[model samples]
Target: MRVASEMGGVGGTTVMLAQETGLARLVEALEGTAREIDVTFARAGSQLGEGLGLFEGLKERLTTLSTDLSGPEIARAGTTLSGLAGELRAINDGLLQETGVLQQLAAHSKDASQVLERLLEHMRLITILARSARIEAVSVQAAGRDFGDFTSEIVALTTQAQRTIQNCARDHDHLSALLGSALEAQRDFEGRYGQALSALAAKLEQTLVEVTGRQQRSVALTSDAATHSGKIAMAAGGAIIALQSGDSIRQQLEHAIKALRLLAAVTAGTGEGAALDAEARTAAGIVLRRLEAAQLEESARSLAQDADSIEAALALLAGDTAGLLDLVRSLYQGDGGRSGSFLADLEADLAEASDLLAKCDRARAGVDRVTSAMSTVLDTCQQTVAALAGTVSSIVLIGMNAGLRAARIGTGGRSLVVIAQELKFAADQVAADAAQLTPTFAQMQETSVGLKSGGRLDAAHFAALDQAMSESLAALRQTGDRLAATLDQLTREGGGFASVVAQARLSFSNAGAMSDLIASGAAELERSVAEAAMPDDPAAAAAAAQLIERQVWPNYTMVGERTIHQAIVGALLPAQAGAAAPVVVAAPAQDEADDFLF
Candidate 1:
């Protein structure tokens, strides 16, 4: 009877120890899971912070960009650009008119040049007549003694006339050169300069329209991004709150696990079987209640919801960022080859226009040169005509004197009189030719004056137009570059924010999975505790205890606690009651509150 009683005591102690060990293992598992959850929650919080930081930074930049776009400066710039475009169009129209005028002037100059060429031919004829007169005078020198001086005076006048004719020919050549240059310039203006100006004006108009549209889009996108950022921040805040809640739940679980371990230790140390049983039953009930009320499943669900919210917010932000990227890209891309980018096209067009304007200026200068040369020709012609008039009067007076002298000298004087009359006729022809040239000279002078004035006006317009185009294009390029850079930064930040959100999402998923696993383990522990509390025969109880110690406890044993299995097995199958009580090997010392299962 004593032996049976001792055996019962040994069995009871073994069962109690087994229960305590199992509870220790369950507590350690719970503690380890709680620690893992806490760490995951912390990491998730950090990721959320990183995501929120990126979002806030991006929001600030976008807001600033939007503000700049809507500011008075941008409005003024747009207005200035519009005004410049209008001015360019007006200038282009004026240029077209000026080009037409230049064409007309070139044609008129050509006609005038033809007239001058005719006049030059007539002057050459006069030179030839003068040379013939000089030769005749030299040949007829011996025909009359008194006619020699008169003939010499006639020869001097003819030589002077020939020199004047030569001067007129030189002036005509110079004028013709000037006119040719002016004509070439006008042709270039018509073909290249005019077309470039028109194209630039059209491009500016298109650019202004596109820029205005992009500005509006940027404003709208920025507003939307800001709004979305607020949503994202709210979502991150929620996730942070959820993570904080999870951390609190983890702490609660740790405390509950510590309490369970303490209960197990108390149950194991107690010597009375009934008290140990009652304590074990109480511990099981407490653990079951705690497990039911722990609300870990709720935390997991909340975390999942928070993760979903973050992902959704991130998606919206990504969409907005993509839209902004598209807007930036559209600002610079062009339609075809050679027109590589809008800025590049504008720069090239402006450069070509500037060169064209310079050419126009040079052409105008050529017109001025032509005017100077024509004026010189007119003056020379006037002087020559005046000299010829004087020369003709001298010849006529000399011819009349020779005739009088001839009448005195009789037959010898008769030949001299005929020569004098012929000289008079030649002088009359020269005078008439000079008279005709006067009107031609006046007409040429007037035409040249008109051309000079018109050219000056055209040059002024070109200068103003060129300046306006350069300024407008430069400002537009600068603004566009700045906007593109801002958009690029926003895009990069958006990507970084998305990455952070992704990491947070992954962390949340892992934490949720871990939480679910812990919850399941808690449920299983509760079921095991309930099963252990049921009434069973000694053999069955021992079997149950052995099964739990060997199977369940080994699975949850703390790291570096390999001897726990031997301790548990030895406790379960102690030596026969009289066989030194199997040395009752004690369990390894463990600070259950601080220990972990994994």
Candidate 2:
């Protein structure tokens, strides 16, 4: 009662003016601060949502990229490389065989030519002996005129033999030179081209396997991506919970605004002999100011704590997201714009293999042509050797007949007999030479035949393989290119989460500052309260701090907010200060209750 009397009376008009200009404005300002906090938290939550959006479908894409890298498309390319290698190897071996046979045929040609030349010398000697016999028989004139025909026949035979042998030698020379050229080419092919073709074939296949194998390693990358995807998914879940803190803070701020507005109501008393005098009212105002200060402090702390959590979650999410991008990029192997995709590399290897294999094919085909030409020349040589043998036989017969005729002529025929004997010996020598040449010439013909008839090297799968492999590689290229594009898009769009997280963190950290504004406005209104009331007492200040006006209790839509206020705030309405139990609170509006969940 003494405190009430000390709480000097204030007129309603004066109270209204003070409340209108100061308390009312403070209430309006607190409402503004509360809205700002709502907006700020809303935006922060939205930003967190955006951060989570960057990794959607990322795991599936990574798995697809891994599968494409090791798919059957790539395997087909490898097979093509292997097939080309085999074809080139076969050509190398075939050419070697054909070349060796041709080389042998050339040697045989050289030997036959030598034999034919020796036979020519013998034929010349026989012609000399036959002519000598003819001249001696004519000098004796014992039917020597008849001997002229024999000499003529022998001369004709010698001439024919000389012509035939010379023709054979010429043909042999031509064939030998041709075979020599082929042999030289074969040497070059074996020494240089053979190893090169083999290497190209092997390297084409080996490099293809290696290249594809390297790409297949992307499957290993999926392991890391899968882990990162799990973390991102989990972190996103945590972030969802952290983001919901905004709604809770928004509700708290709304409650704080309602408290300030109710303080305005206390200043404008509802009718009557007066409930709270200026002292009581002034004390209550101070209590509200302090409570708002506590609320502001609490709101700031909540914001900072939630912000820290969200930012941490964002940190992990961003890192894992970036890691997934890295894994996807590895599938392309930095071959994005270099025109060096898996398909490109495979095609290049195939082209090189085709080129080298084609060269080997041409070389083998050339040997085939050389062997064919050698066969023709060898056939001619064999015929010439046979003709020469026949001519030598005829000359031997003519020489024997001359010898017999000379024996019948007695003394005059003795010189003719000696000539005939020498002629027969020379003819025999020619026959011997021709006989030796026949086997050599026949061997050459056989070699030429063998070379022409040998199996040819083949690469019949080139056309089919090229089409099949190219199709497979084309598919792989599309997948790889898509992955490269995804990685590039990620780099441009979501690559830097650090800055985004920082901005969000900074915004949320300013939540404490917004609360400070509300507390500052409250202090300004308290100055008005101090002016209207008597000097502040410590007891009144404690009572005011402990007051929880019933006006604001209805707005405690959240159960946690009400529970926390009753337990930790140690606050109660002035009317209920001496109650036995806690005051009963009204249930929130349906709309408010609908959104009461944090």
Candidate 3:
């Protein structure tokens, strides 16, 4: 038993190791694949960089070679030709001088002339020989240089040709070897192909058996699927009917609520419409009770639509608050108590409504917009299908007509058969498109009617808000104008008061300085007068001092002169009943006047 237990444990461990090994190998393979992908990308990047660098280098080398070899060679040859022409001209001049000397020697007859003639002939011959030798030497030198250049070029060409021949021979040998290898490979491949074909035939036989079995299974599956699909379609139809019914009920409830709310508002506005008001309230209560009952019993699907309607109504009511406030103000004639009471209650109610609407609005709008967009899209699809059908029908009719004419005309009737078949196919396609579009359009039309009705309700609600906003904007404009006028008046009055204060302060400061100057001058004059001797009798002196026919006043006046004159005028002037009193300044008393002397 112990041996068997150990064996079993070993077996279990071996199995676990095998499983772990398999998992490890799977992970390694995945890692290897990822590494290979990264390596491939890196290699591609390197190759692309290398290719670009090589292209740029090659371009630069080719441009340099073209300039250095072809263009410079032509320019050098032209310079060489110019030098050769100058040498030829010098040779021609030497020949012409030699010819003239030979003519002069031939014209003499004495022994000296005969000797001169022989000498001139020798000179002419020497000159001709020298010129010929010079020309021949230059030609030989040029030929040697040309031969050397040609030899160098020939050697270079020969070297290139040898390399090309070697390469061609190597390539030819390689091609022969490759051809032999290919023949051997082809023989091997033919043998493998026979084996492969035999295996493929066997696999085909097996596959056909499997396919036949699969087809049988598919047939059974298809039948079962058809049955299940029929059941599912029935369920879907029932669900759609239930959904639509729920939607209808929800719509009715929303309509009833809207009517009741409107009636409530109207009744509240009226002072005495008791019987009609009672009837309206009774009808509203009945409708409200029915709606509330329906809401409790209805499916969750209708709640979305109800939520949407509630939200829109709340938004409209909130937007109309400013209008309501204005109407209340008009009724109360700006009485704070009445306005405050009405506004507080109204705002509280509106706030509650707004909160409730916020809750339902998001859900409602989402569903409605989705439904609306779907209907719009479906309608557009129908239109597109109809247009496509029209085009296809026209094409089919034209093709059919053309085919029929070709069939009547002659030998091309065989080709026209294909055209006829295509035309028939096109007609079938158009008919199928129309069939599909008809039901889609009908459904879209029905959905569109629902959308239009809902849209009208939403528009009406928003229209009230639009009107209220317009009124608010107008009131704001008037308030802005009034505030602007008040600001302007305040600014102008502030400026004027500031100017008056500044002038008063300046005048007061000037007066203080003038008073100080005058007091000092008067004290000095008093000392000088007292120090002067009085002339004889007191009465005569006093009479002489007092009697003045004309007195010249200085440009500067005493500080108290204006003050004194103002005081005297104020005292003598009669007071007008409605006019304001004038200000007066009192003169300083005796002690106060004496104190200024210091």
Candidate 3 or 1, higher TM-score: 1
Estimate, for each residue in 328-357, the C-alpha lDDT of model 3 and write its tens digit.
Answer: 223212234342322233223233333322
What local lDDT does model 3 show for residue 226? Answer: 42
Off by over 4 Å in 1: 1-27, 46-57, 67-161, 185-194, 214-222, 251-303, 306-365, 378-450, 454-503, 522-598
lDDT top scorer: 2
Each model's TM-score, in the order given?
0.62, 0.73, 0.19
Which model scores highest in TM-score? 2
TM-score of 3: 0.19
Report clash pairs, candidate 1.
406-413
Candidate 2 lDDT, 326-366, residue by residue in tens: 55554565355353454566666666765665565555555
> Candidate 1 on 351-410: residue-level lDDT in tens?
665675676567567655665666676687667767767866776777678667666766
Better of 1 and 3 by lDDT: 1
Model 2: worst 10 consecutive residues (lDDT sum) = 579-588
- Candidate 3 stretches with Cα past 4 Å from truth are 1-350, 359-386, 406-412, 454-456, 459-598
RMSD of each: 11.7, 6.3, 59.4
| Candidate 2: residue 19 lDDT (0-100) | 53
lDDT values, one for every candidate: 0.56, 0.64, 0.33
